[model samples]
Target: MSADRETLEVYNARAGDYAQTMGRDPAAMASLRAFVARLPKGGRVLDLGCGPGSWARAMLEMGFEVEATDASDAMVAEASKVEGLAVRKAVFEDIDDVARFDGIWANFSLLHAPRAAMPDHLARLYRALKPGGVLHVGLKEGTGERRDRLGRFYTYYTVAELTGLLADLDMVTDDLREGADKGLDGEVAGWFTLTARKIVPDTEARTDTA
Candidate 1:
């Protein structure tokens, strides 16, 4: 099976437990809160790969118009339970909108995409943003792909590698950090955190054209 499908199956089977286990650290939440604070007031934001919707809820409480999405139906169901949150079912490639969102919180989700498709996916994300929009994505730092003990697939990216992948995109770094994953599952997880702003073009190009 493809990595996306395989990972979806695993997540569907464990969505409830996974949702329950997804608790954010106070420090991380505080940082995210500050990040969102920088956006235009009541901005439209997309919570890409919004597992269980905690961030969506937090963003809603902070007064942003939030759209949350995930590929796993179970995950979508879990996230939809958050009343008033707009939820959808979609994979990474399903994102093809142009100038739609002011911000996108990818969290630890985009790691499921295949390495070969990373650039195209990043470009789609770039096109999906409004002028001067910001983006935040996280990934485990490594080379190539692997399956976790839970049977979920992950495509890792080194800091330099990720930097290279993003270099050609129309964005500038806000923050990129190398660190440990806070060991949520009892093991050290190498991680790379990225925050960036989509550069506003003088004249927008046709990003999606025949």
Candidate 2:
């Protein structure tokens, strides 16, 4: 799914400030490390909507083959500044490869897409991963879509709503975490991160459902 223009513009203009505001805490660092440990050494990973490439850079430093992507030009530029990082400009819909990545990091990125488009975008992401590949997503917790004070669009989802969506696509939820935090707009919002794995097929029925 394409990113909302105003939201994209906000990120592009504040890429630096955004980067400065984001740094992994002890808990976050542990989560990242846990995710890395789940993957094969040097496995291919896609950092979807990688704003400033912080997570992508961390993964690359850990010796993974990383590809970072964002829809904003400035975000892409910032990501490119990282030595040895391979970043590109593209929307979520641009992910067309099948079973290519061993992991997909879509943290807080897909929230910009319209609620109605979430299923299709997720389906695309699911298709991009190899069987048994891992997917991690972070999203604000709420019931509807709205524009934040910063003029950036957001689509919120309840845990049950999101869990159902993933279940429909045959993704098995593995880990879940929830809390509140201040974002670029200085608002404390509740959010949740879910890590899921694409189930390896045991029969033709599994592949046909997706």
Candidate 3:
């Protein structure tokens, strides 16, 4: 089976347990909060591939207007059930908004996309963001594609690999960190986390995604 289909099938089959067991590290949350704090007050945010809407809920509580989506219908259903959150089902390449978001969060989601599809998705994500928009992403560390014990397909990247990929999309790096920690499945894995900004030409000295 294709990695995309395999991963989605796995997520659809395990959405309930996945949501139930999802974990939030205080430090990670703090880091996210600090990153989004840079946006304009009550900025609009898109939680890309938001599973179960945890970060969507957090962003809502923090005063941002949050829109969310995931490729998995089951995951989207779970996210939409949360109070004040209405996530839709959508795939990575389908994001077509132009300068529409102040921030985009792809926490542990984009890793499921195959390596070949990454640049295209990244380009779409870049174009979807408003100038100066913040982009946050999380992925595990490894060389390439593989399946976890749960049968979910994942594409890993080194910190340098991630940097090169984002720069190829013309994104400006704000922060990148690598660490080993327990994932939601209660298994320890090396992780890559990054916060980057879109800059527009001749505007506050920032780069443009449009």
Candidate 4:
């Protein structure tokens, strides 16, 4: 397993490259648009692991109040440079806010988290969202962990595994789709995209079919 310190170092080293690559992806922008369309108008959004603030910028353009955060200081600096974004440097494990967000966009960020930490991360995400708040996660579709040439660690998940994990948290998944496309590294990868909604107080008693 890659240590958190090493992971952060790898990302910090490549932060500028990652930001540049993300800026040129039209598909990523489209996906961000689709994710935001599911949210209510003028709601608060937390872009977890927001790199370079692109997604946060898009959300701001769509009339949502957004807070962008990442673990790497370099990334936070880049994100803060974007106009109209509130950027912070934070690790996912350090987030302890409760019921403050109307939506959480975690695009391709959780994949860096160790599998053992996924449950707790999901719980934190649950706690961060308001009742009926939306959570959109984009993950690579597979299992186990691997390191790319750049030495960044990545964890992949199967749909059933991811769905089961979320279901255990009382969050009902509203949609799941396969999103295979060429990524920044010029390699085709399969993506599992899910949109889950927090169960409201009155609806908590109902069973989730997702």
Candidate 5:
């Protein structure tokens, strides 16, 4: 079955429990910190599908202006409880702001979007970023989709597939890696992480396009 509103609602109902178990994976933390280090000082960052605001909190603590959004109301509420955080309750498809963010951290979130929906989602992310903005995406690397016992849908990606998608939008990848990490289940999980920068036109091209 396709993941719909009800599926998300179910996930939200368990948000607290999920937070307790997978609050912040250590590997995820390291990846995010590295992504932040490459960004300009005090840059505006958006945490797409930010669950419980862990990464958002980290970025805010680092002095970046961080804004977050999640499709689950329960997750949003939980994220808001974190001090000094702006958490929006909205789906990725609802995001419409353009050229406003310097960086976007979509850690382990876009996997919920089906393969067909990813291109449009990526386009929206590209539009939301300023010229030369960066985007960091994390996903489980595999062949198909599945839902774990917790009922959240996940889609995996191969490095080549992901790179091709980003390239189609003219984004230059700064980093990409695959590795194993502990999963919400008790087993090790394989995943891929990618960081890419929005390619901007040079002065001559910008002037002409303008």
Candidate 6:
């Protein structure tokens, strides 16, 4: 399934508020820098679920081709205001590219999808990346699915669970970070970031008898 209707409405109505709360942070940009460092200069990157286009704008400034997309009309409108950034209206399920992008930044976005749909969404993302391409995923560190006090739906996951899911899709988990922070909801929560790579053809078919 896609994003929940109430969640979309909340985002539509409070887009500006959310942007204000999520304004660019130097530490966050450091994470982005690390992500881009793994990618070649001028590589094409997809900012899946880009909110307010901050990261997309940063990547554009860093000289990479970026496709910034989100499902919310308000978000797309906000992201389009940035000059030279190609923003589009798209949901996670709308992604259907095959080995097209050198990297995908799915930070804090796919957590909105239902837990049952995560495997398919992850597989689609795997196919969307070039072999050996990098993928960055940020998710709330927890269990099960529920709605926040702000009326937004969330699907949480443990690090091990997500690691297994990525393994099933032949993506190698290489980097991880975890911490707690207060969100727009005024509540401190745990979250984790995972950086993985799509397995290349030879690695996919290799047999390890050791």
What TM-score do all the candidates reach, one by one?
0.89, 0.93, 0.90, 0.89, 0.90, 0.93
Instruction: Summing lDDT over every window of 10 consecutive residues in candidate 2, give the lowest-scoring window.
Output: 22-31
Residue lDDT tens for model 1, 1-210: 123777888878888888776764554565477569668999999999998898899899989999988998988999999988999998888898999999988888878888888888889888998988888887888888888876677898887777676678847865665666544345678887777788766565455331
- Report the C-alpha lDDT of model 5 over 35-122, residue by residue, as the tens digit: 9987889999999988778788889999999999988878888889889888887887887889999999998889888888999989
Residue ranges of candidate 2 with Cα displaced over 4 Å:
203-210
Query: Model 4: which residue pairs collide?
Result: none
RMSD of 1: 4.4
Full-model lDDT, candidate 2: 0.87
Q: Tell me the TM-score of model 5.
A: 0.90
Question: What lDDT does candidate 1 reach at residue 21?
Answer: 67
The residue-by-residue lDDT of candidate 4 on 111-135, one tens digit each, is: 8888999999999999999988999
Candidate 6 C-alpha error for residue 18, in Å:
1.8
lDDT of 6 by residue, 68-168 (tens): 88988898888898888888888888899999999999988999999999999999999999987999998999998999999889999999999999999
Off by over 4 Å in 5: 1-3, 204-210
lDDT of 6: 0.87
Give the range where candidate 1 is weakest over 10 consecutive residues by summed lDDT. 201-210
With candidate 1 superimposed using the best TM-score fit, by how many Å does residue 133's alpha carbon deviate from the native?
0.2
In model 6, state the lDDT of residue 17: 84
Query: What are the clash counts of all predictions, listed in order?
Result: 0, 1, 6, 0, 0, 0
Candidate 1 segments exceeding 4 Å error: 1-3, 182-186, 203-210
